[model samples]
Target: MFASVFVVILGLLYCRKGSSQSFLGRPRLYGPSEALAKEVVYFKCEVPDYAGDEEIYLQLFKVGDRNRSLGGYTSLRGEVGAIPKVIKPSHEGYLECVVSAQNNSGITPTVSHPHYLKVIDPVKGAEIIHSDPMEFYEGNALQLQCQLSAGTHVSYKWLLNGQPVSQSPVHYAADNLLRIDRTSSKDSGSYMCMATNTFNKTTVFSSNSSEVVVTIKDFVSSPNIAFTVLKEDSQNYSAVVTCESTRGTPPITFSLYNRTELVTNMTTDDRQATFKVPLVLDRHLGWLQCQANNGERIAYSDWLPLEVVPAGGPVTMHYDFDLGENYAIVGLRFYCKVKKGSHLRYQWFLNKTLLQDRGSFYYVANEAPKQSILLLSVGRSSTGTYHCEVSDSFDNTTAISSKKHYLDKDVLNRLPILLVAVVFGCFTALILLVSICCCIGVMFRRRQYGEKSLLNLEMDTMRAAYEGDLDLSVYNEDPDVVNAARGDEFDHASEASVDE
Candidate 1:
């Protein structure tokens, strides 16, 4: 009985010893590496459960500041424990987790490896900025910067046309800045920036900057000038001149010149501009030329030769129609012409009212002085009888009017053919009249030659019969000598007749 009691005591001692054992391995601390200031941070501590029935307590604190605990979690079941703490800028530093178990053997502590908590300030109100001239020419350098109101550990990237821009030979992207070494037309687009911290990659922070438009302009190219003569006279010439550049940016300044004299200049947002130029003979207008300037460069067009042709003669008017599908008349064209005139001024009268610039409904194109056109929309006041008055630009009083004619496409089509036939008949009659005049002239010359030959023969016979010391060849060569010989013979014949 004493031996059995001693064995029971040994078993009880072993059970007490086993109940006081400590945790086996160190605790593992898990948390975010970086966190925004004034944000809630969670730390998890996982400890090995050596004695399952023991109470476990975990503490999270900075490594160097072991005196004060940041947060704590307790578990009676000895499971994974988590603690949350409000992290501030002051809380940025190294942190660690310590877990302890309390049992019959008192408390045992196991510390985890140090963890780094980098508290950061989020970026806000990001924007893109640029300075100096807003417009850049080709081959010019461009620079832009990303700016933020408040941030920490900030990084920047550039975006163009909503796509991420990578570094290239001509394009450069660095922290907070983007640059183009040499700008071109293709480089023109919208530019933006994104400013963020490393935490934004996995966090809810965003710092996209507002977009800024970047413009790259093209240099002005050599210009060319073209002109259509509207009217001309002995004193003045009028034309519509166009100045153009094949390739260039807008807001171009175009200047028209008559030799060295500047006639006019215009500033337009397009690459081409038109000017109405009127030249005078007294001023001695020379060749017309044009110049284009885009603030970066200047170009000039080749000289254009311009001359004046005076207007003259019988004025006539004809009509034609621009037909659409199904032979529908969409537009009407009235042509006023002068048979022998150039640089003529033309005016059209509908009933009696003058049609001067009646909005877009009417267009007047005097391509040449001899031929002026009045184009009209079919339904826009194109009805009624039409007559055209024309004259030289120098003299309006000499203007002549053509007979009024009602416009009917079907009737006018046959009118042109009839007019052509009439013109042909007049030309043929002129040729016939010239031939008849030539025949009459030949007959008169032959009759005069026969009379002179008969007179010369009569003089030769009289000289031979009389045998006088005078040269009868003088009578044939000189008409006055032959006339005197004829008078003497006629007087002798009168005497002989009187005696008979």
Candidate 2:
């Protein structure tokens, strides 16, 4: 009888269900399998036969610890419903899932899959707004498509200043007319949009667009300085004249002429603009005129005097800064860049390299990236070499440049001062050259006199220094000089030194 009973017990144990049991439904706990515990997390569970009218039960247990089960706690007990409830997790650990079928055979509870939950800090709210095409050309009517792409249902608010611009003169709501009727230059300024969500709120505004000068008779102020290509076929030669104007009601119109023909005519809503004249011979080098009118007043720019550069000189680059303007804000800004070319497509270079500028200045205008403009907003980092280069299939040349180092120590207010310094520096250098030539003539005279005076090795080196040849190419083999020029230091000196 004992043997039979033992064998029967073994057979019963062998008949136990598979180790992994699939619980179709019976309300599983909200375990993300691994989720942010304690966060208002949504959980759902499904049972196989707990159909409509039949209710299943749920219980909670902390796995591995000696603890009583929280039975039938009533988290969610609907037969037909998928158990989905948002519950905050109590602790950071593995949550054991114990489930059982209700309204049935009262089967023993089966353990469900184990899941680990983690709790973390909450996220900040969103009321941050960033929009492209922030500063539009004035006078065309504003179309600001405002939207808060993020935040916790942040409330939206738009303001032109401290005043609530909730309505427009032409519309019932301030949101419409992104339009300004008879737009004028005085209307330009910063536009700020605000959005606030539940968690956090912040604001961003476009840089002041006061520079967005608009004319009632014309449009937004265009680049006053412009250029033309006269006698485009001339042998890589051209004449240039800088344009300037003193008075006018903006929306002023000016045309560029190639002798008797016009190449480009531009209008402005503000004070100044530049025009470029193509490289040409004598006939094409006529007066370069800029005319400004806004229906109320007729103003003309002084006829720019022309200079024809010699063909043999390399294409030169130049730059200028308009610091006298009181309205200017940033210290480092590009005011103007003039480019001259015969063959190469024009491209601007910063620090001797090409760059498609993406800066505050770009936000101010819609001109082509290929065309350069004046920049303001100067900083320490803004100091560098800027130039324009044009090239052809055969050769490329840098035609214009404006360097930051052109001024004297005290007269650093403008580049023209620095340019004068460079000229004086060069002139000084030329005089030194002449003196050296005279010395060489004297040396020949001394040699003819049959006495070696002062052309010794040291003297030769000193002469080289005065000539700006800073090379340390020394021959220690000279019996007269060694200790002062030997070993590792001498080797380094010779290798790193420049001859000029």
Candidate 3:
């Protein structure tokens, strides 16, 4: 009986001890390290929804590809803590961290989902600022500057028209400064800078490909070959050319010069430099050169040819359109616009004939003369070659623009009324001339011998068809004295008759 009790007690004690446990779960694989280099930020992981008693323990780790453990931690709590640890990567590349969980309930482990870290490279930016003198000339100097920022160990490159710049070894040392000892149009192009650097075995770069234009110190500008005139009447005005040298530094002014005499001037903006004038002067007939300087380096443009031509001819304010005159529509006005108070000797012409610009209404001077607009009512008679001539009077020179507009005769033919009146006027003038000569001969004859002839009266009236009635009666009058008085008396009646 004693042996049996001892055996039962031992069995109870053996059962009392805990020994039903499972091996640790398979290891979880963390994600491969990856970064966008521009947008990605941080990542991490740990045991999921953990809730346990008996002092749960956990570890953080990094496992090598060779299956050897590289990193981990101890004393980790198992109560919904240490999850998504928020890991940050220094550079762009693949990297990872591992978190492990443990508990006494089974002496096993649990793993949360794996995560990835990413980094991004941002785009670079640059700005160029500059200015030029109001009137730049040759032998001038200009200095230009550009600024930018990018990634570490970054190298820079400067380009003109997509080609790398070899000039100015100092500026080319590392794509930043663009020095123009003496600039010209050839230096003008789409300019840009590029930066390249390595970030965690990945390349990050930034660039700006906007254009920069270089201009020269020049005089009057010429009308472009691609120029077209609007329907402006005979008016003097100005033409403007944007002389841009976007690579210079500020407070620069631009000026206009006619030969050796200076005409107008202006300041510059960050992007564009401009030269404006009243264009009313023919000064632009010559090469217009734009010059710029940055107080150090000077630049100039090839002469640009420009002309200050009138828009059209002058006509009555309300000329007779006569209903069907469509061809006369191209030109609407004539103007004698004064671009500058100094160049105000505004003069215009039609077919070499001086336009009668009386003091009251023929011309207009404006404050903003460079871009001034002129208007003069136009008519068919005024629709011919017209000229806009301007002189500073000081240059001992003149600028002129002559242009012609030929209305389609076919269009004018539609208005046969005006043509008919012109032709009839000419015919009447011819007849009057013939009548005058004949009457003179007759008067000489009548003074010698008093006489009357029926044929003479008929001839007088026939010729009078063109001459006035007074002259008609004189030639036929009682062949004598009353002739002179009759010439005066019939004058009014004949004038009325001829008008019809």
Give me the candidate number with maximum lDDT: 1
Tens-digit per-residue lDDT, 1-500, candidate 3 = 99999999998765643221222333333433544434423232333443333344444343224253333444344332222333233443333443333434434455544334444344456555456542344335544455554343446666777888776533333345556565543454566666555555755566563555544543222211122222233453445566655455454555555555555556654435555544444344665665554455545555655664332233211112223354444333343443333332445565676665342223433322232223433444545555555544323244534344343324534557878899999999999999999999999998756545766787888887867644555466464667877788899889999999
Judging by TM-score against the true structure, name the best candidate. Answer: 1
Candidate 1 ranges beyond 4 A from true positions: 1-23, 30-34, 38-120, 124-135, 138-141, 147-285, 320-333, 339-344, 351-353, 356-370, 374-385, 392-395, 398-400, 403-500
lDDT of 3 at 280: 43
Q: Estimate each model's TM-score.
A: 0.45, 0.23, 0.24
Ranking by lDDT: 1, 3, 2
lDDT of 2 at 468: 80
Better of 1 and 2 by lDDT: 1
Q: Where is model 3 more than 4 Å wrong at Cα? A: 1-60, 65-293, 299-500
In model 1, the worst 10-residue window by lDDT is 228-237
**C-alpha lDDT (0 to 100) for residue 82 of candidate 2:** 29
Clashes per candidate, residues 3 or more apart or on different chains = 2, 46, 64
Every candidate's CA RMSD: 26.7, 31.2, 27.6
lDDT of 1 by residue, 1-500 (tens): 99999999999987766555444468899999888887897889987645567677789989978899999998787778889998877788889998776443355577999998888888888998888465779998898888888777777878889988878899989888888898888788888898877564676455998788888899888888876555355444667889999888888999998899999999999999999877553243579899999999889999987654445566788777787867677788888887765456788888876878454567878766548888877663566778888876656766888889776545533447778999999999999999999999999999999999999999999878786666565446577878999999999999999999
Question: Tens-digit lDDT track for model 2 on 91-210?
Answer: 446655555556533445555555565432222232223332433333445444344322222244445544444454732323212444434444444544544333112232221111
**1 or 2, which is superior by TM-score?**
1
Indicate the residue-level lDDT of 255 in model 1: 93
